[model samples]
Target: MESGKRKIRHEFLALRNRMSVDLVAVCSAGIFAGIKKLSAYEKAKTVMFYLSCGSEVVTDFMINSAFGSGKTVIVPAIKNSGDEKMYAAKISRLEDAYLFVYGIRQPEINSGNIVEKNNIDLVFVPGLAFDIKGYRTGYGKGYYDRWLKGVPFEKTVGLAYDFQLTNQLPIEKYDLPVGIIVTEKRVVQIKGDRGADRWETL
Candidate 1:
């Protein structure tokens, strides 16, 4: 399952990389607008790191809005030798977030603002593709899955463009399903308790 997931994620990454600049811009704008709409809900008090890709970038847009409205925001800072696990880092300034050439946004290693996962109220997840059923295929590091183990959050939201979404995805026993998925076009509500709806898809 891990190998198959890696192959699919690689294929999707290649396709996303080949998108024309115009299309990329349009998708980014649409996804950003969708995130902004979510920020207006005013229900979340604290949110976990937003996992995103180069095409799925969500700048301080949602973070700033949430912070301004009194919500605590956090971002993931991957740890470990192979970057297979991550810890949440609190971010307040635009400068606090740094871009990595490999298509991830993270805070500096010594940023000194990291926090525990239990402190998070919501988490914005990322995926190569996700289905209406809530299964998500990530980069295969199992970082989010490992980190989310046992920790509780009010909501776990997957952030993606509509194109990155599908009807299903290959899932592993270790893979975690999100409670809600937010795309540029729509929001999908999955069945089951928070992160328990793991469906196997290929």
Candidate 2:
């Protein structure tokens, strides 16, 4: 399963990397529009957003828009400790971020404003690929999975481009699925209960 997931991850990464800058920009705009239309996003007072890096769906627009709308924005910061645990740090501006793992921008950990898991109202997850069912293949780090274990599935969302959506993906017992997937083309709501959902895309 790990090998299959790795292959799928690489394939999706290559496809995303091949996208033109203009196309990425256009798709990102459409995705943000769809997110803004969601009642969950509208009602959330505090949101967690992953900073985009490489071929991932761009999230600067969403982050900035959240700030402009007076929403509390929290970005993840990786700990250098052996556990490499992920923490939610409050970021007031983009300048609060610095290059972290794999040159991905992350908020400063020492900011002294870590947000509690229960305080988070919404979470926008980043990944290499996602199926309509909400199972996602990340960079193999499992940071998002571990961090999301405590959050309610209904508040978790995966942001992706249309091309990244596949029909199915390899799943593991520890792999956490997102409750909803927002793509440039459409928003898919996974059906059934939270953790035990059948992994069916609605």
Candidate 3:
């Protein structure tokens, strides 16, 4: 499963790297629009969003919109500490959220503002690819996987492009499937196993 995941991850990374700036913006806008239409996001007071980097779907618009719309925005941040665990840090300003870049001076994030896991109402997850059933594989860090364990599935959503959706994906013991996945093509809502009535495609 690990080898399969690695291969799929590489393929998706290469695919994303080849995308034009216009394509990324267009698809990301569509997905972001779909998110805003969801009742889950509408009801969420505090939302956790992954700071996008590299060729992954850009989240700047979504994050900035959240900041201005009276919603508490939380981004994943790691303090300069021995522990490598990803914590939910509330960021009021876009500059406070750091990016994975070289030669760029990073802003110091105060660990004192770490929010509890239960405080986040909605989470926007980033992934390289996602299966039709909503299982996703990321950059192999497992940061979101570990942090999102035990989180209600309905509250978590995966952001991806239309081409990133595959028929199947490798899964591991700790891999938790996403409850909803939004792409430029459509929105997929997965409640449980395939037999569940909650399984839906929007």
TM-score of each prediction:
0.79, 0.93, 0.90
TM-score of 1: 0.79
lDDT of each: 0.68, 0.86, 0.81
Q: Which is better, 2 or 3, measured by lDDT?
A: 2
| Model 2 misplaced stretches (Cα beyond 4 Å) | 81-83, 194-202
Kindly list the per-residue Cα lDDT of model 1 for residues 68-122, writing each as its tens digit: 8787778888654466667788877656666763567777765578787776777
Q: RMSD to native for every prediction?
A: 4.3, 2.3, 2.7
lDDT of 2 by residue, 1-202 (tens): 8999989988988999999999999999999988998899999999999988877788888899999999999988887635558889999999888887667798767757888889999999998888756788999988888989878888998999988888778999888888888888888887645433343433
lDDT of 3 by residue, 16-92 (tens): 99999998999889989899889999888999888777667888789899978899988876655444577788877
Model 3, stretches more than 4 Å misplaced?
80-82, 100-107, 194-199
**Top TM-score prediction, candidate number:** 2
How far off is residue 34 in model 1, in Å?
A: 3.6
Ranking by lDDT: 2, 3, 1
Total clashing pairs in model 2: 0
Better of 1 and 2 by TM-score: 2
